[model samples]
Target: MNVETITKTLNSLDQLQRNTAIQSDLFSIEQTSDLTVAAALVKTLENLGVRYAFGLFGGGITPFIASLEQSSIEVLQFRHEAGAAFAAIESYFASGHPVVVFSTTGPGITNALTGLFAARWEGAKVIFVSPCTSATQRGRWAFQETSQYTMSNTGIFTSGTLFHYATTVECNSELSEIARRLALGVGKLGGFVAHISIPRTIQTSLLTTPLPHVNFSPTLVTAGEDTISKCLQLLCEAPFAIWVGFGAKDAALEIRQLAERTGAAVMSSARGKGIFPEDHPQFVGVTGFGGQNSVLKYMQEQRPLRVLVLGTKLGEFTSFWNPVMVPSRGFVHVDIDPEVPGAAYPYAETFSVQSDIGAFVRAILKYFPEISRSSSVLPLPRPEREVIKSHLEGLVRPEFLMDAIQRVIVENSDAIIMTEAGNSFAWGTNILRFAAPGRYRVSTGFGSMGHAGTGILGAALARNRKAVAILGDGAMLMNNEITTAVKHKIPAVWIVLNDARYNMCDQGMNMEGFHNVDAEIPSPDFVMIARGMGADGIRVSRECDLEAALEKALALTIPFVVDVIIDPTRPAPIGSRINSLIFHGK
Candidate 1:
């Protein structure tokens, strides 16, 4: 049979097996009688491959916590709700699976907003379980009541702003629907966040019927014959480049092959780092903050005829919506999300395709010519290593610290690196190199400050590998989850750049010709604080001491912190940000 026929037969058999397995699992669950609403919910989560639940306990969620205790899911309790939520987000990033975050009503739910916003913006799959006051306690102002119809009108949960699917389960019969929705949400492309608020009364309600079967497999969209023909025709012509984003992460191998076969240069968004090996000859450089000037220069000079944009919106941060980067012949945009194609470059000549990035790339490969070897174009010359190193000197230059961290990362290639918002993220993204996908995580979408510090624990747990968080002093003070990491004995290393200032804002203000006195702040000795929190701590002030400190931190069995005093006078390289802010006033 031909390739298309074989593919269709295999897909059909796969669906048949999945359906049979679901039926068998449901039959087995039907024999169990100890199932309540809470137990059913936990079972659904377990079947969906949820292995971790990160959150704090409260009276409203007592029943759900008890259910989790009896299941295989490991419950990680955090001191704050936001930390738990951030941990859940990172867990999703590491595992590519949805993680559960539980919180009680009122204050607990409110506190988790920031983390949930971060998750939503970064496109991580998370299931948030919040127990609200019982249905009978409606307008009585019960303690920590957060019902939609209550006096406070806590409608934000279902406002459609933060979550892909949000609902209140007032009846026990809604568990099956909730399970199905959760599965669908988790299976969707680009990830999704789901919120299921169960009333206290419903938690204890008995389920009389057998749990419904939920088998959800995401649809893989492929380019149509006509679209494929058009793409092949366009790609066969010379003078084209490829722009990759986080959404194209799953298709890395195909992307690399396509780049090599077509002799096209490749550039990536910050979130898309490591999707294509940054050191490869075809890779131009990363775009956006902490990005390289070489890629911009290459684009300006080469001015390729066509640009193939894979699974990216080309948002303001990635493209700065600059006319110079848009290319002369416009772009051919391919993405799973139907609306993302023309969202950013509406005025440019665009060919939009709504398809799964991987499937589309594989389809393109089917039509691609088979050559003995790759014929990638000549790579642009990079800046001299000595010149780059000279600018990175000093005891606390951000570049110096990044270089030291990169060395340690090279030694422990399996270790995951997380960077917080601000100069740490800027310098790390620009300087550090990731050789594999999912080894680098950052919060560029929401740009939340404390994310890396708090999220590292979950990432380490999810991957069962050492996690290093590069964070700024301002963010470290704002919301470090060092205590949580210590409490769980998670292997996390915090490399704090102690600049004693909100450096990104400070530098941005200076670049914009404004002097803001509030940017400066006192730097606390993080070693003392980390030691006080029952974790290993080290302070490094001299340039000679950085490598040793990093090695020591990475060798620790428990959580560790390294505090390096950075020079505040050395401005962070944020030229792109300054220009964008000046022109766009974002």
Candidate 2:
């Protein structure tokens, strides 16, 4: 053999060895041109700490999903696209990391929209990936067509109300910029929802250059020194009350300190429960939606001169924008979103401060005088701790059920407690008291029916611990991922409030003076359904069995369900919601 032939043979041997190594080892994102666009994107997401991908796979997205399987990222196939999207959102909260939601063409894209909207409203970092029709196939009556000719590109493929950042990848060159944008988005303050739609052809195309290396430096939006000083001055001007929201959850410790230091009464939004210890001496009550009457009583009897609002919009659900919630002087509102400070009650006086809730609270803590730590001497209003004992042989009352949960789940296990919208939300928010943050979650913003029911799987899988969801029968029937949980062996528990009707609607109609609304649903045996899905379950008809069933569910390693036959006649603590509706109509 000649010298040229010998050199060519050596290069071919090196290439074969490299290919063999690649096949034997796990997939790596070391800037290799040998990777397909889909593989490159998957690797980039893994680098950015995306550990899970939730979706319903289809032919169009097979390449991306397949790439995910090759990497360390766990790809979870859900029963429905919406369930997958909801799961993605909760996983981020449970794990404190970004997650991915993938879908295929047309119907798949539309199916995931509701959950994606919830993800945005609840403030979660979710990266959505989908496959659209190729350029050549556009408008050719292609199956499940997803192109400009067949669908609107305005919001789905572009950044708008639906997505914080969005784009469609038509070529290999866009991968670098796309990766960079994703890194920056997930690292930005608050929620960042992004969409990257790739054509079927580009997913399989080989990369020309290595994907760019990007660093995620999460930007903490803290108030400047001048802003902090102004906030200090306003806070000290009078006796102020601290209004906590879900946004201020990270500042739980600091909020407690501040509240104690200033002798300020602490109250939380419906979704903001547990951010401040509900049993604290200074805690007044929860506000809005399924709020307690204690809050209104506190506002009426001992109204603060100025309210210090932390990380809440004070929207209709949080405040009802009721004049009662308004302080005598005004509000000193601080939130990451600059617009939220005065938007709820624009006519009212507000000293708006835009900053991260936790950081801002820490700043305020430092400026407090040492003497203020002993200032909590005045009498304060406390939330009503109504106790109702379980009967020996009657249907399970919602209050009795909540009491059982507070003992069996809330105090016993570290499981994250979630409540679905409607009566379950009403009961949970009104009754269940938590002492710490991150132990409770409720979607009051979008208030989607099936979020908690479906989201529990993701929460369990991401946290690698038990996550329990309390939902009504309608929500359980609407959307759930029990089979998915069984498939993944995720430790999730569902506590179903089986009332055989849409109780919230049923009760609300009666309160509204409307008669005989068709809100009833034929109750299915949720235990049987769970068994069919390869999970264990228990049905509780009498209130006496409630705690035992909950304990059994929590002790099990597999996904479990506890179905309590709730009494439909018993009204939920939704008087506030009914009153709000009455006010809105007027």
TM-score to native of every candidate shown: 0.92, 0.94
Question: Candidate 2 at 415: error in angstroms?
Answer: 0.7
Give the lowest summed-lDDT range of ten residues in model 2. Answer: 16-25
| Most TM-score-accurate candidate | 2
Candidate 2 local lDDT, 1-586, one digit each (tens): 2334433443343221100110111222465668899999998898789999999999999999889999999899998989998899889998889999999999999999999999999999999999999999898989999999989999899999999999999889889888888888877778999999999899999998767767654556776665665667677777789999999988899999898877889999987999999999899999998888889999999999999999889988898878889998899999988888899999899998878888888866865765434355558889898778879977999999998999889999899999999999989998999999888999989989989999998888888899999999999999988999999999999999999999999999999999989999998999999999999899999987778889899899999989899889988988877888898889
**Residues 249-290, candidate 1, lDDT per residue (tens digit)?**
899999999887766789888889899888787788888888
RMSD (Å) of each candidate, 1 decimal:
4.4, 12.9
Candidate lDDT (C-alpha), each: 0.81, 0.88
Displacement of residue 358 (Cα, Å) in model 2 is 1.6
Kindly report which residue stretches of model 2 are placed more than 4 angstroms away from their true locations once superposed: 1-31, 372-377
